[model samples]
Target chain A: MNRLFLSAIFALSFFFMQPAAMAADIEINTPAISAIKNSMQARHNQLAPHYTSGAVGLTRDGLIAVRDAKAVPLKDRQSVNTLVAAENKDRNALYKEIAVANQNPQWESDIRNTFAQRWVEKAKAGWWYQTASGWVQK
Target chain B: MKQHLPATLLALSLASILSACVTINIYFPAAAAEKAADRLIDEVWQVKERTDTPEPAATESETK
Candidate 1:
């Protein structure tokens, strides 16, 4: 009788734990998310040089910004501007896509904030990133 | 008395489980979302598997 009671309690606890675990895990492997990730990955190569040269930096708002316009040659400035614009556009779209994939478009801002923190956290040494105070080299 | 014990325990467990579900659903889950974002960012940046080597010089074509 005691064994049966213990087993029943264990099962009930497991049942209750399942939903909590699911609620805590954020899903990022949906088809829409995968496509966005691929696009971002492709763009990273283009952006890598600028990041290394300190011409561009990751912004606090989950976007990239051209930190020092003069870092690029005068002739290449326009191209750098174009690249930054395209990257920001794609990033905004990606956040929106992830929220939509989760069936909660209202979560877009939350998703963006999450990405903002993650980007800074994952930044390489010598890369510039914006913080609450100002730009800092990571 | 013995028959009522199982029913009472079941009822209490069900009530607790429902409350837990409600609580879990309400929060924004900021930590989990950040973790997921970091995972994807790491993959894009190739952070872990990168070799320490100088990048190629900018070719004339790339600048143009």
Candidate 2:
């Protein structure tokens, strides 16, 4: 009777643990994803100073505004255009890196939502961010 | 150079192993949306540039 009871308990525990074990795979890809995100964020941070400085006259918004606001006559339109193009590339790569962090699609959505909120919070004065009520003030 | 051939090969192998792993998707180009951001920034800049007081008392005196 004791042996039968032990057998039943073992089977019950195994059944209960299976779902948890499978669920953990969703997390298995997450560490890899996090690593990618860190690297991409680092890349953006690395470029941000040059973008912020008048190197090619790229504003936070992008090139044209920086051209009008900061650049001297010596800095040609082509320079601003080139910087804008590079910034676009890096920004696009940033999102791709974040998305690839995990195999699970849900993790991608979660990461997107998280960054969307962070972008809003970090926006400077007069920096218009999206809102539920349309493009109202930041 | 002859003495370090094994070290270079080992370094290349390790680099390949590391390079095989990384996941990240690029984002949509933010430049497309930058125009809107600039419009807003311009508005804010204009507000800051015009540092005037309300001048309510002056208006009241003129009214009197």
Candidate 3:
């Protein structure tokens, strides 16, 4: 009788609680970052010939400053530059890997350059970025 | 099997937790919507008397 009662309670709890717990509550929106991400994608497409992928990795401060504009301190600009350099290196490596993965046969440099130009055009005013002209505003 | 009861319950609990990724989508006016508004305002912003063409049907591409 006790075992039966326990089983009934357990079954009720599982059934009653399951649906509420399974509901989704995810929201995906960050306008400022989105603006930057769009700029980056445009940059990637423009630079497609130079690299198979144009994803320059972000540094610690670079990542934080992307969304929270107020977070960038004056002293962190050097860190941001370092981040840009690191990100560029990663992007270079990533492109090579992507090309290898996709087996793209030609015009890698041209595509990558186009992507870089697009990146330059779309960058937000204050984001740290590196260009052939050297590090400058996004 | 005595220990298995607890293990089975734990597995079920874990599965429930894993499966419960709740995503809520709240749609606000997107960029396209803002652009459309801008275009509409621009077209109508000029005051050239009251003899203008009637509003045309919105394009599918514009909404998207």
lDDT of 3 by residue, A1-138 (tens): 546655765676566455444222111123432343344443433332212112332222212113232344566545544554544554444333322322331323423443344344433344345644544544
lDDT per residue (tens digit) for residues B1-43 in model 1: 8976876787687778768776876666788888889888987
- RMSD list, candidates in order: 4.5, 20.0, 19.3
Off by over 4 Å in 2: A1-77, A105-110, A128-138, B1-64
Tens-place lDDT digits, model 3, residues B1-64 = 6856865676577556434422111222233223322332232222133244343466466655
For candidate 1 chain B, the 10 contiguous residues with the lowest summed lDDT are: B51-60
For model 1, the superposed segments whose C-alpha errors exceed 4 Å read: A1-22, B1-6, B51-64
Candidate 1 lDDT over A76-121, as tens digits, reads: 9998999899889888988898777665688899999889988987
CAPRI-style class, candidate 1: acceptable
* lDDT sort, best first: 1, 2, 3
lDDT (Cα, 0-100) at A74 in candidate 3: 62
Which of the numbered candidates is closest to the native, going by highest DockQ? 1
Candidate 2 lDDT over B1-64, as tens digits, reads 7956765665565445333321112232233223323333333233354454242454355555
DockQ, candidate 1, comes to 0.46
State the C-alpha lDDT per candidate: 0.83, 0.40, 0.37
Question: What's model 3's lDDT at B26?
Answer: 21
> Per-candidate DockQ versus the true complex?
0.46, 0.01, 0.03
- How many Å off is the CA of B40 in candidate 3? 31
